[model samples]
Target chain A: MTMKIVFQKTSGLTDKPTHYCPGCTHGVIHRLVAEVLEEMGVLEDTVGVASVGCSVLSYEYFNCDMTQAAHGRAPAVATGVKRVLPDRMVFTYQGDGDLASIGISEVIHAAARGENITVIFVNNAIYGMTGGQMAPTSLIGQKTATTPYGRDVSVHGSPIKVCEMISVLDGAAYIERVSTHDVPHIQKAKKAIRRAFETQKRGGGFSMVEILSTCPTNWGLDPAESLEWVRDNMVPVYPLGVYKNKATGNL
Target chain B: MGKVLMKGNEVIAESAVHAGCKYFFGYPITPQSELVAYMARRLPEVGGLFLQAESEVAAINMVYGAASAGVRVMTSSSSPGFSLKQEGISYLAGAQLPAVIVNIARGGPGLGNIQPAQSDYFQVTKGGGHGDYHTPVLAPASLQEIVDLTKDAFDIADRYRTPVILLGDGMLGQMMEPVEFTEGTEIRKFAKPWATTGTLGDGPPRTITSLELDAESLEKRNWDLQQKFAVMKANEIRYETYLTEDADYIMVAFGTVARITMNAVNKAREAGVKVGLIRPISLWPFPEKPFLETRDRVKGYISVEMSAGQMVEDVRLVVEGHAQVDFFGRTGGIVPTQDEIFEKIMMAAGGVTV
Candidate 1:
C-alpha cells in the first residue's frame, strides 16, 4: 500500500553511465562529490571543471554547468570562472598527473593567490587515461608502464604529497587527503568533499580535497585487490585526515 | 573623453575599459607590460577585475575560463610569453570561447631580443596554436587605430565567439599619440546562451568543452567552426588603401611599418613614380579585395616588414602571380626606414609599365 522512495542516485550526477573500467574508484569519488553538491543544494549554481587524464570527461558525468579545461590548467580555469561569477560555486576535478605535474604552477599560484574556489584532486598514483604511465604521485617502488623497472627514487624521484604541499600555502583555506579503500573511508571521503565545498560557500578561499583513488585497470589488479593495494601501499605514504583546515585553525 | 596623448599600449587598456571589458588577466612582458600596468591602475577604478597572472600560460587559461563564464575577458603578452599561452589559446579556440589576446610582438625564435618585430605574422594568422582554427588578427598601425581596434577586438571576439587577436609591435606599444574615447558610448551586448554560468535551473547542465571523442562529432564541430570562420571572414575582413587610384606599384605593410610605407608612398609620388600603400588592418583576411581591383593595374606589390618577409606569403597568395610579389624586410627587430621602402618602390618601378 505504501509506495515510498528508498535510497536513490543524487541529482548532482547525470544518468549517463560512466566509461570508467570495472573496479576503478573514480566513480565512487565522483559520486561523493556529486552527493555533497546535491546535499548542499548548490548543484544548480555550481560550475565543475573537468581536467585531463581519465577525469577529463567528468564534465559529461557531473550534472552541473561544467567546462573541460586544458591539461594541467583546470585550477587556473576555475579561478577565471569564480572570479567572473563570484556568487556561483566553482570547482575543478583534476587527476594526479594533471594537477601535480604540468599543472603544478597553476595549482600553486591559485592557492598562493587565495582564489575563491575549490579543487577536487584525484590521485590514482598513475596516469590512468594514458594507459598507466607513472604519475607525479606514483609510489617509490610502484611500477607503471613508464616506470617499468619499478619507480626509482634515484632518478624518478619520490611521489608528491599534494595535500601536504598545498597545506603549507597561506591562501589555502582547507586541504585534506582522503581514501576510498573501504565503506568507512568512503564515508569520510564524502565528509571531506562536503567540507571543501562548504569552505567555498563561505568564501573561505582555495579549498582542495586530494582523494586517493584506485586505478584497478592500470594497477594490474582486480577491484578487490586494488582496494587492498591502496590500503596496504598508498595509505602509509599519504596518511589520511585534514592537513589544513581554515575553520578551526587546523581542525 | 577629450583627446589625450597616451602611449599606444595604454590606449589599449583605456579603450578596453570603455568597451566594458570586465576582466583582464595577463603576465608582465616587455613592450606589453604597460598594457598590464595600465589595466592594473584603470580596471579597479572602473569596477573591473585585473590580475597579474603567474605566467602567460595561466593568464590565457584564466581568460578561457572567464569567457566560458560569459563575460568580456582578455589577456596581453609579448612573443615569448604569447608562445607559453598557445596551448590555452588552442583550448579556447576549440571551445569557441570569446576572448581577446593582445600580442605586442618582439624578436623571437629563441628568447630573441625585445625589439619590435613582425615575425609573428605567421603565428597570429596561421593558427599560432596547434589546431585547424584561425584567430581573427587586427593589425592597427596608428595609436588611434589601437584605441579603435582594441574595442573592435573585444566586439569581434564577443560577436563571433572566437579568440580575436590585436597584433601590435614594440613600436606600436611604445609610440604616443592623441586618442579620444567617445563619452557615454553604449557597450553593445551579445547573447551568450551557450555559456556555462552554472545558473541552469531545471534544465540540463551545459558543458563548455572541445573534446568530442566521436570522430564524426568532432568533424561536425570543425564544420560548425569553419562556418563561423566563414561568417567572420565575410563580415570582418578589413584593410585601408591610399593613393592607389592609378598606382603602378603597391606597397604592403602592417603595424608600424605601414606608417613608414605611407611616407614612402608620398616620396614615390614626389619622384613621379605612381606608388600606393595597402595597410591591411585585418591581417588574417589578408585584404584580397583591395588587390582584386589593382592587381592588374600595378606592376607588382612589395611587402615591407620589420621581420623577414612573413606577410609576403599571403600577399603572393592573394595576387595569384598576376603581379610580381616582392619582399623588402629586415629581420631580428630591424625597423625599415621610410627611405628603405621608397627604394624598394623605385626598384619595382624601374621597368614595369602601369
Candidate 2:
C-alpha cells in the first residue's frame, strides 16, 4: 500500500502566504525548488541568492537561509557564498529582466568562471514587477507598457537566448532550458534542477536552468493561453532541452 | 595570527581572508591594484576563489554572486571604478547583502588622476549609489585601522546584512604601517543555513530577492534600512581629535590628508599659529557630533583635502554660520607639501605669516 506523504514546509520561504497572482507560474516554480530541496535533503546547508525583479521578496517565501542579491548579481553573490562555504549549496533565482539587462556582466562571468553554483533563472518574457516593460526576452513585435507599438528590432534588439549563449562557454558544466507549462515539462524541469544541484555537489562548474515561465497578468492572457503562448513563442527562440551537458550526450 | 607591517590595501585583502572570505572578484585599478594582486596570490593558497573580472561592473557583480551564497566576499577599486560599481552597490544595499567594498580613492569628476584624493567624500557618505540607503563606511586613517576595520566590516556586514565600505585613499593604499594580526582568534566559519548549497534536510529551497511590488512594502523595507543606519551611526561612529583646545582655527581632514594636516598643525603651533586638527576615522556618520560641539569654540575652520572643496561643504553645513570655514586642496594627481598647507593655515589665520 502506498503511504501518503504530506507536503513538507520549505525552509527558505516565509510563513506568510505568497503574493503571486492567480495562475502565475512563480508559485509552481517555488514549489519545484522546495520539492527538489526536500528530495536532496540539503535544505539545512542551502543558502539561496535572491535577485531583483518581481520575485524580490522571495526571501519571505523560503524557510532556509536566503540572501537577496542585486539584479543579475545573484550569480556573483552565489560565487561568494559557495567559495567561503565550499560545502554548502549556493543557488540564485533571477527573472529575465534582472538577468538580461543590468546583470548581464555578472551572469556571463559566473558561468565563464565555472563557479560551483546553480542558477535557477526564470524567464517570463515581460517585466512583471515593472508594469509590463519590454524585457530582454520579450518577443519581437510583442507589446509592452514601454513598447506601445510592437518591439522594434532596430531600436530595441531581439530576445536573448541565455541557454544557447551559456552553452558556448567551455567552463559551464551544465546548461539547460526547460518550461513549466505542462506536467511533462515540469518533470523535465525538476530533473534539470536535480542535475544542476548534483553538478555543484560534485564540484562541477557552473550550471543553469532557464525556466520558460508564465506571467499571465503581464502578458494579458489567461493562464492556459499564457502557457500556450510560451509553448508557441518562447520555445522557438529559447528551445527546451539540455543545451550542454558534461555528464551525458543526450536524453 | 601574528604581527606584521603592511600597506592599507594589503591589510584589507588579508583581513577578508582571515574573516573567512573565500571569494574575491576585482579588476586592476590604480592605487588599489595591489589589493587585487595580493588576493590573486593568496586566495588560491587558502582554496579560496579569486578572479580578475573584465571591468569594475563585472567585478562588483562577481562579488554580488559570491555574497549571495552567504560567503564573506570583497572587491576593491579606485574613484572611477567606484562610479561603475555604484549600480551593483545600490543593489547590494537594497537587498541587504553583506559584502565588503574597498575604495582606495583617487581624484575624479572624470578620468581625473591616479594620485590620492578624498574626493569621494559625498559619494561614500551620502550613498553615491541610487537608493534611499546607506553603506556603513569606515575610513581608516592608518594601516592598523585597515586591518581592524576590515574584520569589523565583515562582522557588522553579516550581523546587519548590509554592505560595508573601507574607504582609504591612494596614499594610505601605498603607505606602509605596522599591524598586529589577531593571534589565535579562530577563523570565523559562519554557518549560513539558507545558502544554496544543494537543498538538504527536510525543508524547501529558499530564494533571495530584493523585489517587493507593493509600494507600501518597499517603503517599509527602506524604512527598516534607515533604522539600521541609525543604529549603525549610534554604535559605529568613530573619530580622533588632536589639540582642539584653545585653538583659533581647526583643520578638518581624513585619511592621508588628515595625516598631512597634523604635521601642518604641529608646524603652525611651533610658529605660534595656535592651530588644531580634527581627523575623521569614520566618514559616514561623519563624526558630526564632536565637530558640532567644538564648533562654537573655534574661530575658523579649514578643510584640507586633495579634491577641490568637497569636505569643506560638509563642514560649512555643520558649522552653520558659527565660524569662518575655508578650503585648501590640490586637484588632479597633486599632493600639496607641508609648507603649502602651513601657508594656507596662516592665510586663513588673518594672513599672519608663521
Candidate 3:
C-alpha cells in the first residue's frame, strides 16, 4: 500500500507563482509555516502578521487569517491580538531589516515579557524586499548597495545577535536558529517551526525560530552560489542549533 | 436627574464600564490618570480587559486592536499624551473601527501646563489626526452629563463606525458632582465575525485592516465614510438652547466653558441684558442649524472659550458674516472667570448702554 498525504485547503495562500526570485528561500519557508499550521490542525485558528520588507505580500501567501503590520511592529500587533484572544494561534513573519532595526524594542519587550506568541524571523543578512539595502545583519565588510565597499563596524555598529539575546530572557521558553540549504537542514527547520507553534499553543511563553535564508537576487549571487554562501559565510556568523528548548515535544 | 457627589474622572471611567464597555487600554497621564486606575480595577471585575500599555501610542493601538476584535473599547489622556494617540485615532477612523477616546484638555503647544483649557476644540472637531476624516466629539459640562454622554458615545460611535471623543477639560476631570446609576441594562453583543477570536467553528476568519492600496476602492471606502458622517450630522446633532426666544444677544460655547457661559447668561438676564446661550452638545456636527436660525432675530454674537479663539472660527462660518462676531478667551492654563465673561457679554450687548 502507498502512504497518502493531504495539504490544508483552507489556507489563504494561492496557487499563483510566488513573487520571489527563482531558488529564493522565502517560498520554502512559507510552505513550511503553512504546513506546520496544517499539520497541527490550527489552520483556521491561526492569524499571521506580515512584515514591511520583502514579506509584505506574506498575507497573500498564507491561507489562514492575516494582517499586515508596520515595519518592526508585527510583534506588538500580535501581542495585541493574542492578549485579546489567548487561545488563538498568532505569529509574525518578519525579515532581518524589520526585526532588527526600527522594531527592535517591540520584539525585545514581547520576548522579555514571555508573551505566548511565535516569531518566524527570516534572517537573509541583507535587506531583500527593499532592493538589497544593507541590513542590521549585513556581515562586516559585506558588500551591498548601502555598504558599497563593506560593512564598516565603527560607523555601522556590529550585527545584532537577536536569538542569542532573546535566549537569555527569562520569558522566552524556546529559542533556536536553523538553516534551509538542504533537505536534512530543511527538515530540522520544520521541526523548529513546529516546536515554536506548539509551545505557544501549550500556554508556554515566547518562542522564536530564526531561519538563515538566502537572497540570491539581493546578494548578487547565482542561485547555487547563494545557497553556498548561506552554508559557508552565513553559517559561521549565525550557527544552526537549538539555542534553548524547554518544550521539545515530539518534534 | 439629581446630582450625586463623585470625582469627575472616576465617574467617567465607572460610567463607561457600567454602560457596558468591556475593554480599556491606557497609559498613565496626569489629571486623567484616575480614569485609567478606576478602569484597571473595575473592568476586570466585570470580566473585561484593562491593559496599562508601555506608552500612550501603544495604548491607543491596543484599543484599536480590541475595537477591531468587535469589543467596546476606550482610552483616555491629557493634552501631551493625547497628541501621541493621534496616529491610532487616524487609523481607527480609516478602518471605520468604533472606539471612545477621552481628551481631558490641558494647556499646550507642548506640555505647557496641567491646568484646564478648551484649546483642543479645533483639534477634536476638525480632523485632529490627518487625512480627510472627522470624529464625533461630545462636550460634557457636568459629572451627570459625563456619565450620560459617555454611554451615548458608544452607541453613536458604533452606529457611525467612527471614533467618538468625549472632550472634557482638566476642571471637568477633577471636579466632584452627584451622579445617578441606571438599573441593569442588557448590552447588545455585536460580534465582528471577521475577528481572530476563536470563532466557535465559524466559516472563515475575519480581518480588520485600514489598508486599501487600490485607488478606486480606497476612494469608495472614503466616500462611504463620508456618507455615514452625513447621516450622523443629520440625526445625532445635539445641543441646548436657553432663553433664545426674543433675546437681543446669544452666546455660543461648549464643554466646561459652556457651564461658565450659562452662569453669565443668568446674570445678564437679571441685570436686564437680554442675553441667551446655545450650548453645543455635539461639537463635530456643530449644531449649525440652531446658530443659523438665530441670525434673523438676535444682535451680534459673543464667543467665549479658554483658548485664544478656536471654535470661534466655526461659529463665524455658520454666521456667514451675517452678524458681528468677536472672541474673548484666556490661553495657556488661565481660566476665564464667569464675572469676566459677564462683563464681555454686557460690553458686546451695547457698549454698556447703562
Say which candidate scores most in DockQ: 1
lDDT (tens digit, per residue) of candidate 3 on B1-72:
445678889998988997789888888988799999999999889998887777777777767666655678
**Off by more than 4 A, model 3:** A1-12, A21-23, A126-134, A142-150, A248-251, B1-4, B198-200
Chain A TM-score (model 1): 0.98
Off by over 4 Å in 1: B200-202, B351-354
Q: How would you encode candidate 2's per-residue C-alpha lDDT over A1-251 as one tens digit per residue?
A: 99897856654355788888887898888878877875888778878877887888777876677777766667766766776677887788899999887777778888888888899999999899879999999999999999889899999998998888888887799999999889999999999999999988898889999999999898899999999998998888887888888878531
Query: What digit string (tens of lDDT, one per residue) describes model 2 on residues B300-354?
Result: 8999888887878878888999988888988786887888999999888777665
Q: What is the DockQ (computed on Cα atoms) for candidate 2? A: 0.43
lDDT string for model 1 (A211-241, tens) is: 8889999999999999999999999999999
The positional error of residue A194 in candidate 1, measured at the CA in angstroms, is: 0.7
